[model samples]
Target chain A: MSVTDELLANNAEYAASFTGPLPLPPAKHVAVLACMDARLNVYGVLGLEEGDAHVIRNAGGVVTEDEIRSLAISQRLLGTTEIILIHHTDCGMLTFTDDEFRTSIRRDTGVKPAWSSEAFPDVEDDVRQSLARIRTSPFIPHRDSVRGFVFDVATGKLNEVR
Target chain B: MSVTDELLANNAEYAASFTGPLPLPPAKHVAVLACMDARLNVYGVLGLEEGDAHVIRNAGGVVTEDEIRSLAISQRLLGTTEIILIHHTDCGMLTFTDDEFRTSIRRDTGVKPAWSSEAFPDVEDDVRQSLARIRTSPFIPHRDSVRGFVFDVATGKLNEVR
Candidate 1:
């Protein structure tokens, strides 16, 4: 069976005892932007329960225009006042360069993407970059409340990125 | 204390007995793109453990250029094959329109965004759009294995979307 089917079965069990209908705005007025890595449990690692925070994730957790767009809406409309950017060690993003990945994809598929992969060699540096992006964005109203961190997949630890 | 400080303290407790060093590639060969709603535990509801699957999340879990970029790398380099697009009920995306939200942000920060918020009227239809985006992306190598679902945040249930 596909993993989707397995997950569907699992969701059935989860739904059987589900108790929710959490508030629309997060209780803490916080939002976390973190890597989509399977090992990093943003909520569990951070001790956040349902309705506590909004978690925005993508590969590498790097801030992008789209991410800013989301954050704008998150803060302007949803009452979120804080942002946390988290990137992790051993990230696939750390494994490649923009040029090399572009070339690789170009060879695999006949089309070349116009956007950069936003890859970086250092996870902490990437985190700092993301933090800066959020801090400087005109759309984000809670710039001073933003911070960044690096999650160690092996140790399950998060180290602050300045 | 900020939520980041609280999360750091929690991470210390979590890291004390942490054990990992899982292989770089996910064991399940699947990637799930879901909303970053604090209530939807992507891993728990899907019965996924660390190192099993890659979970990519954003505001609405909408398929954007960056998401496709990430999927390209997920499939081309990391060996992830199947893709699951999941959107949830009562999403913040459902609370406003692109134009209305743009107006709000513009009013709040005097800066007009150049991109769309990707807001939608129907969560199920948004799931279908994301699925189609993945299925048609030239960068994604495992398009044939793509599927879509709408998760019920209130009930912890996921309904397939065509």
Candidate 2:
């Protein structure tokens, strides 16, 4: 079976005991933007249960335009106010650059993507950058309620960037 | 204390028993793109452990340029092959349109967002559209391994979106 099939099977088991119909707005009125790294459990680490917060993740947790778009919707449409930007140590983003990755993909697949990978050298710096992006965005409603952190993959500790 | 501060406190408790240095490459060779809704536990539903799979999330799990950028990296740099596009029921994205939201945000914050909210009325159709985007993107490798599903928030069940 494909991995999707396996996950579907797993979901069947989970759904057997499922308790849901949670409210549309998160209970805590918070939104988390974090790296897509499999090691970081954004909810478990943050002590958030189901229906507590919205978790938006991508390659380095960088606050790109798309992230801002989501945040705007979260704040304006769904009532989420606070924003947390979480990057992590040992991120795959730290291992490569946009130009280098673009070159590699072009070489392998003969396609040069117009979008940047948004890689960074330091996780903390990247977190700070993301924080600034949210704080400065005119579309985000709760700019003053933003925070940033770098999660250590080895220890699972989150170091505040500010 | 702020919600973020509470999360930081929880992180401290979690870090006390932290496991170390999971490999950068996902062990399952898979990636899941899902909605940022708080009710859906992407990892738990998929039975994914730490370092098992890359999970990319956004407002609606819609495939955008940035999502493609992240997926390209997941496939090209980190050895992930399969992709799963999962959208869920009761999504806030079902509530509004690009023009309506843009107008609302403009009236509230006096700034019109240049990006689309990527909202849709039907979650299953949105999942199919995301799957098609991934399949058609030249930047994404292993497009044939892509699948789509609509996760039922109340039931915790995933209905395949053929």
Candidate 3:
């Protein structure tokens, strides 16, 4: 089995034992955008339970189209009013230049990666650029509150970067 | 101090201890959309380090607008190509129905949640609903791979649900 497969199976085994669902806190329904890095234990660090906050994760801890659509629905339908964006330290997404990544893809697959960049060539601008994208998105409810942060994987903590 | 303040301080201290960036793996940059359940550990289950995958989180692992904007930049600038949507068992966002959530907001904040079924509904369909959103999102590159899973908070296992 692949590493992902092994991981998934192990997770299922563990989950089967939870007998009952964990207790959830009465927090203001919150929507958080965070990175998917395995090192970040968001629940433990945030002192949250299963039902406290809604979390959305993607590459580079950056948001994507589906995320926006969901967030729209979350605010419109779900009880989430707060938006917390969490990026993390030692992030893999920040490690490579676009050219380097493309080259790796070519070397591995014998074909170049098939994505485009309206603002590539400028590798250093990713953080600010991603932040801008979220802040200005039209799909976000105009009346909702939104905030961003950077989480450090090694430390298990959060930093308010936005 | 507030829990958030404490975590923020911990994050800063942890970040200061890093000598330099950690090594990044050559794996295809994977983006994960996961729920914000405190019991779930993305790092422990996935065996990921400080820098591995990109994680975007929201309530019920549902996608939203802000998430989409971030994802667009991730695809456009960050090196992400695959998406992993993780919804865990015993999610809190599921506890309250749309009316309950909206009622809670009204009682606490004195404002009604916006967006109606005409354009947006209060209750999200489910993990299946979330998966469909990812599959049809326009921002995701047509060639990039997107997969969805359900993470069991009790077991730390992720299963492909879509």
True contacts kept of each: 0.66, 0.83, 0.36
Model 1 lDDT tens row, A1-162: 877788789889888988887777888788899887777877777877777888888778989997897788778878888888888888988888999999887887777899998889988877878887877888888776888888888888888888
TM-score of each: 0.97, 0.97, 0.57
Q: Ranking under lDDT, best-scoring first?
A: 2, 1, 3
Q: Candidate 3 lDDT, tens digit per residue, A1-162? A: 344554456555555554444444324466666555545545544555445655566555555555564565566555566666666666656655657655654665466645532223322344456557766765555334565676655455565653
Winning candidate number (TM-score): 2
Q: If ranked by DockQ, best first, what sequence of candidates would result?
A: 2, 1, 3
Q: Provide the lowest-lDDT 10-residue window in model 2 chain A.
A: A3-12
Which candidate, 2 or 3, has the higher DockQ?
2
The candidate that wins on DockQ is: 2
Off by over 4 Å in 3: A1-21, A26-162, B16-19, B22-27, B107-110, B116-125, B142-144
Cα miss at B159, model 1 (Å)?
A: 0.7
Write candidate 2's Cα lDDT for B50-105 as tens digits: 88999999999999999998898899889998998889888899988888988888
Q: DockQ: which is higher, 1 or 2? A: 2
- What residue pairs clash in candidate 1, if any at all? none
Segments of candidate 1 deviating more than 4 angstroms: none
Q: Docking quality tier of candidate 2?
A: high
User: Candidate 2: where are CA atoms >4 Å away?
Assistant: none
